[model samples]
Target chain A: MPKEVAIIGVGYAGFRALTPEVSYKELMYEAAVKAYEDAGVDPRRDIESFVTVAEDFTEGTSIFDEYVPDQLGAVLKPVHTISGEGLHGFIAAYLQVLTGAMDIVAVEAHSKASNILTPDEIMAFAMDPVYNRPLRANPHFIAGLEMNRYLCETGTTREQCALVVAKNKHNALYNPLAAYGASIAVEDVLESEMVSYPLSRLDMSPRADGAIVMVLAARERAEELSDIPIWIRGVGWCNDSFSLENRDWTNAIYAARAAEMAYRMAGIRTPWQELDFAEIDDTFSYKELQHMEALRLCRPGEAGLLVEDGATEIGGEFPVNPSGGSLGMGHLLDASGLARLLEVVLQLRGEAGQHQLSDVETGLAFGWRGLPTTSGAAVILSN
Target chain B: MALLEKVDKNIEARAWQGEIPIQSRYTCGLAGEKFFREIMENGRFAGTHCAECEYTYVPPTIYCERCFAKLDEWVEVGPEGTVQSFTVLLVAPDGTPLEEPDILALIQLDGADSVLVHRLGKVGLDELAIGMRVKAVFKPKKEREGSILDIVHFVPVNA
Candidate 1:
């Protein structure tokens, strides 16, 4: 049997719209220091492997991995990068520990979204050159198209989608790390400026600058370091077609397949009953509803109804995104998934002060590489 | 004792424009070559079909997604299709509004399994709806460049 992995320490810095006072390196260093202090282990001494999650286009630099080690103190160690989201980085570290090749691993992911002057242009560069790119519409229109299809196929209404924005922003009121928190009604969301048909300004996640570094270790090392270690019960990731034309826009197939793999590994037969809460991708308001159905927390077309009935609120039965999610916390790009994972860890440990749900032992966190890409990841955690 | 006690104004902030000076050339291999050639020469859209899986791919693929079988059969899809989903973009990528907002739609061609994304013209948002029949408006034969833009835009069938 493979050795079990546990997240012993978690640290983060700068959950804000912009961090012009410090560079991305400094942002990472701050998070690393907190992580090392919390884990009671130094990277130079204990960590045998290091993984950083980043995308080159988002960073505007080629071979971005070369610049990561010095800040995290992983210099001259086994360091690699995953050109995807933070959950993928955590999975990499988990695999390293499971192999017994490394006793302790450090995983880091950060987003300096403010540094990029034209994020939409960078997203466009990632699109199909001949087919999608030449149209020159805003990259976010892809979300609008998907939202329209999802709403139609699932029988979900625009009012039900607006409730997601209302709830998440309200939940963010108690979360200190949330940058875009507000207490607004569904009417306010409907009144917000329409960016694309079926999607309004309030429906989208705002960009934020932040860094998260987590310490993962085998069960043996984890026990020695921290009294409370959040065990990584299962992890799975999937990628559908690279072309948008061939994708299932009405449903998040990548998320569904990834969730199936994870649920099977975690021995979770009934996800809704077994998992306490979820932190899912709400890059757009409709996505929260879509991901819930995709993750099988609710039946198809039932996610919106569940939200409308207060089943996804903090005090509700499912209690989704009690951390405010990307909707309220502000999106951290590659770091978004880790931010969700961080909330689950804190909630599981009873360390989440104000936003903490009652009697939570297990939770799920998910991430999607935003727009025009059919890729996703899911992680299951238990206290 | 405190850090940055002696920091000056000039040293406090600096910004630079970083640019990646590189050009990329992507070749649309064997399948794309056949698909685009048909559009350019015959003014018709072609899809690759996997006989075993009975799946017809638009923006034709070299192999079947489900069966993984080689798709050697090319089938004519549509000069007309239905609007699967659509969006009205009030602003461009640079956040500036055009004189008229652009209506973009995902057109599900008549014979293809997948939808093609393109702009819609000769219709307003009120007139656009899912399942509305629309036809691709190709540019004049002389102006065709074997590109997606060769078809100027999709418009309502009656228009």
Candidate 2:
């Protein structure tokens, strides 16, 4: 059997709209210091390896991994970067410790979204240059197209999609760290200026700046360090076709495959029963509902119904995105997955102060590499 | 020693605004050359057929996604297609309102299993529907340049 890995320490800084005072490096240093302190390990000695999740395009720097070492106190040590989601970085760290090559590893991810002046242009740059870019429409239109298909095929409604925005933004009201927390209604969401048909501006999660650092260790080392270590039961990631010409528009096949791999590894047959709650990707409102079905938390088209029944509310049976998700906390670029994972750890550790769910044990966190890409990662964590 | 204090004002912070000085050229690789050349020369849609998968791909690829078979069978796809999905763009990526709301659709040409992302013209958002029959409207042959823009837009066949 593979050795188990657990997150013994987690730290984060600035889930806010802007942070002009401190640079991205300072953001990393602040979060790293707290995470190392929380785990009671000195980075130079106890931490054996480092993994960071970043995209050079978002960072406006080439080979962003070079700039991370100094801030993370990982200078000259074994360090690498995963260009995908932060949870993917977690999996890399987890596998490293499982290999027994490293007893302790630190995983870091952050968003300096405020630094990027043209967010949409950056997203548009990710499209197929020869084919899609020449058309020159906003990238969010892809989400809108998918939303139209998902709603049409699944019989989900625009009102149901709006409920997701209302629920997550309301849930964010309880999270002090959340950036865009607000108490709004579904009708308000529907009334927001339409960016694309069936997708109003409110349906999309705004950008936020933040950093998160997590320290993982082998079970033996984890138990020695902390009384309550959040065990990583399973982790899975997948990528569907990158081409828009041939890809599933209605279903998130990538999320389903990722979730399947995670569920099989964690030996979870019926996810809605085995897992207490989830922090699903809510980059767009419809995405939350689409991902719920993809995660097998509900049947196709039933995710919107679950929201209607309050089954996904903080006090509800499944309680997804109680930490306000990316919608409430602000989409943290590449760090978004780490933010989701951090909430799971906090809830599992009973550190989620106000919005904490009762008697929760197992929780899930998921991430999608935002628009125009079908890359996704899923992880199951238990206290 | 104390830590460095924070910079408070936007005027006080020193920063430079410049874009990366790099130009990139991407080749569509094995299949794209044939696909675009056919469009440039004939103003007709061409797709590659995979015998194993028994599916034709528009904006054809050299390899079959499902069976990993080398796809070289060229077939005439369509000047006619069906709308698979569509969206009306109200704003540009820079958050500027478009001159007119552009209707973009993913169209599955009659002979191909895969879809092509393109614009729809001469149709209102209310009139457009998934599965609506549409036909490609190419630019005048004199202006054809082996690019996707060679086809001006797709329009509802009935209209």
Candidate 3:
């Protein structure tokens, strides 16, 4: 029998535009302290492994993982880093506990996006040098291209995409941790400065400084540690073609594959009916609609209509991103996945104070590595 | 007793400014070598074809992505193609407006399965539309350096 994994604790620090007073180390340390306390585990004594998610280019440091263990209090222990998104780190920790090699594991992901002054340049550096890089446009141009194709193929209007921005931003107004919270109308989003055609300024999530730490343990260890442990029923991740030239711009094939693997493991036959809510990637407003269809929460071309009908609102039949999502809370880069998982955990535990939804026992969280990469992860959580 | 104290507002936050100096040289692999050579020597676009899967890859690759078979067949594709998707950028990567807004398009070159992303010249945003035919405009042969930029930009086929 496989040992089940549960998230016993979650902690985070800083969801603001800037955190000039604290270094990335201090941010991680703050989150670590909260997580250790919430899990009632001493990192020095109980944590058997540590995993962090970060990219060297984003951190502006080579071998960024070397600086992570110290703040996490996992120094000289089994600590490693995943140069991918936060959910990838979570999946790594989940596998560790499943192997019975570790009883309790700490997973950390953070973003010091405020520190990078030239984020667009850094993003361009990740593009294919001989081909895409020479174009010299902001990386969001890719999103613009994808968004236009998505709308054209699906018959989704720009107005429907604007609804997502309006809804998510409004939803953020109730979330204390949200930095971009607002009660704006769709017209406001439509009128925002156009970054790339079909993608406006409001369509993009702003960069923020934040760190998230999650504590995962085997079932028996979890029951002993926390009264309300959010069980990680299933987890999956996938990467499609690395080249945008060949990728399907109309659909999030990566999210679909990842969701399929996770759903099969969780025995979820009907995602819309089985899962109560989701915290999906909304780095771009149209992405929320696209991911919904990709995750099978709705049929192709139905997500935009569902959002327009208020079906995805907090009080509606299916609530997505009730914690305000990346658009509302701000994009945390590698930590974005963990941020979604954190919200799902909070909602499942009935601890999502003001942003709480009723009768939620099971939830889903999705994460994408954003533009220039067709990589994504999905995690299913149940209380 | 108070456990927290606030930092003085008058005190300035200190930060260090530095950059990692790194440069790289990439070998245009077997596939890239063939693709770029054709562009540099022949002034035309070429793609690799997999007979088993009947798939043509633009920006050619050595092996078929779908069938994993070695793609040894080369076919000339797209001096002309259709615009599959496009975007007009109001600002550059450095956060400044160009003298004129730039039009970028993903051109699905003729006889290829994939699209090439490049700038669209000689067309305004209002005039550019999906399915609009466009043709690659290469730089002067002497100025060509076997790079994607060797083709300066793609312009409307009629233009």
Candidate 3 to truth, TM: 0.98
Candidate 1, residues A176-280, lDDT tens digits: the string is 999999999999988998988789989998999999999999999999899999898889999988787988878899999999989988999899999999999
Q: Model 2 misses residue A15 by how many Å?
A: 0.4
Task: Tell me how far the alpha carbon of residue A329 in candidate 1 is from the true structure, in angstroms, after superposition.
Answer: 0.5
For residues A134-201, write the lDDT of model 3, one tens digit per residue.
77888888988999889989999999998988889888899888888998888998999998888999
Clashes of 2: 0
- Segments in model 1 whose C-alpha atoms lie over 4 Å from true places: A1-3, B1-11
Looking at candidate 3, what is the lDDT of residue A124?
85
Please provide, for model 3 over B44-79, each residue's C-alpha lDDT reduced to its tens digit, 9 standing for 90 to 100: 998999999888999999999888998789999999
Better of 1 and 3 by TM-score: 3
lDDT tens digits, residues B63-104, model 1?
A: 998888887898899989999999887767876555678888
Give a tens-digit lDDT track for model 2, residues A212-321.
99999999999999999999998999998888988888789999999999999999999999999999999999999999999999999999999999999999989999
Per-prediction TM-score: 0.97, 0.98, 0.98
Model 1, position A290: C-alpha lDDT score: 96
DockQ of each: 0.54, 0.61, 0.56
Scored by CA lDDT, what does every candidate get? 0.90, 0.91, 0.90
